[model samples]
Target: MEDRDWLILKTIYEEKNMSKAAQVLHVSQPALTYRLQQLETEFNTKIVHRSNKGVEFTGQGEYLAKYAVDMLNKLRMTKEIVESMENKVQGTLRLGVSRNFARYNLPPLLSNFLTKYPDIKFHLITGFSSEITDLVYKEEFHIGIIRGNNNWKEQKLLLAQEPVCIVSKSEIDSNSLPALPRIHYETEPSLQSVINNWWEENFTQPPFITMRVDRIDTCKEMVKNGLGYAIVPKACLTEDDILYQINLTTRDQKEILRDTWVIYRNSSLELTMIRAFIDFIKSIKQEGV
Candidate 1:
């Protein structure tokens, strides 16, 4: 089958509905149907069974979808290889980045990189660290930048380390933190556990949580408004903000820190674009950005 046919099949398999796939592929429903019919006729097998709810792939369809995905990946790699022979790093850099990092940090970094390599394009996917890690592991992204730690066995580099601190609108006695109306936010499990363990070690009583928010930025805003106190990574705090901050530490007095990491498969470094991107990130890290 042709490359376009593989793309159509892959899109259909992902969307699981002809109408949605047609919309994504920028093709009319009738045209998409005609193409599917042609494929079925050529292969002499039913690819998908239609229903009111959606379409379901038959066994042969499922196998063909997998084949299509492999073929597409090979084609992409081959294209990158051919382009790299010209000593040009011009291709899409697929990135999966943590939502918090994407919001707070990625803009300037990406802007600088783009300014330097105007030919390179980016496809960024923002999600939770766990989701980003999964995407990187699946090779869906050339690289992933995530907060906190993960069990990925890929090539990983520590991008940055920032202090995790307790922040409030005003200074308060250290002993009173356990009784204060603490603001909490949802974060990666590893970071949550670190905060919880720190609290457990410092005080016998649990935190008097006043509110729970979905994101760290919201938690910081609530603290900024004098609603309550929050413990967050240093990146959430601005240098000019007139807020009370207390850097946290383990019971042994080691700093409690949040780490940002760039993860990729070792084999992916062979691509000139991926290698250049990784080196760019390293340069950014060295510059303490």
Candidate 2:
């Protein structure tokens, strides 16, 4: 099949919906269907089957899709290598970052880096730190900016650390936390583990959870309205937030912190854009951004 067919397979596999894939590829649904039919006829096989939700791939289709994704990755790598050979730091820098870092830290850092290297482009994917970790392992991106110290044996630089803290609308006795209403939210497992461990350290009883929310911001709002207290990262709070916070501490009297890391494989450094961005990040760290 041609490059476009490979892209079609990859996009269809990723999107899991024919219409969505068509929209993403900027092609009509009928056109996409026709192309798939052509591919099936050429290969003398049925690739995908219609399902209630979207579509499901046959085993042969799955193999072809996997090959397509690998091919696309190799193609991008080829482009990166070719661009590196030029005396310019220009190419799409594929990055996977945690949603928290993307929301709070990435914009200014991207701004400054782009100011210096105007030709460097970005293909960023942001999700939970856990998801980013899996993406990193899949080698879909050159770099991953993630929160928490995860199981990465490859090269990683500690970017920053934020204190883990408890927040409420008003000050309350530390000893009374177990009895007070607590707001719980869904977050990465690592952060949840840290909070759970800290809770176990200071309290003999379970938290009196008043409400469960889906996001950190929702928990923050619940705390702001005096509904309950929540354990969260200090980076989630702003100066304008009129909430009382107590930083969690370990038994050794050290503050509990959530660390952000810039993770990348050493082999990626062969690309000029990768090296340039790494250097830019090092400068940012040194200058205290």
Task: Give TM per candidate.
Answer: 0.91, 0.94
Give the candidate number with the greatest TM-score: 2
lDDT of 2 by residue, 39-128 (tens): 999999999998879989999999999999999878877877887998688989989998878877789889989999999889999998
User: Positional deviation of 239 in candidate 1, in angstroms?
Assistant: 3.0
Off by over 4 Å in 1: none
* Deviation in Å, model 2, residue 90 alpha carbon: 1.8
Query: Which pairs of residues collide in model 2?
Result: none
Model 1 earns a TM-score of 0.91
lDDT of 2: 0.90
On a 0 to 100 scale, what is the lDDT of residue 278 in model 2?
92
Q: What is the C-alpha RMSD of each candidate to the true structure, in Å?
A: 2.0, 1.7
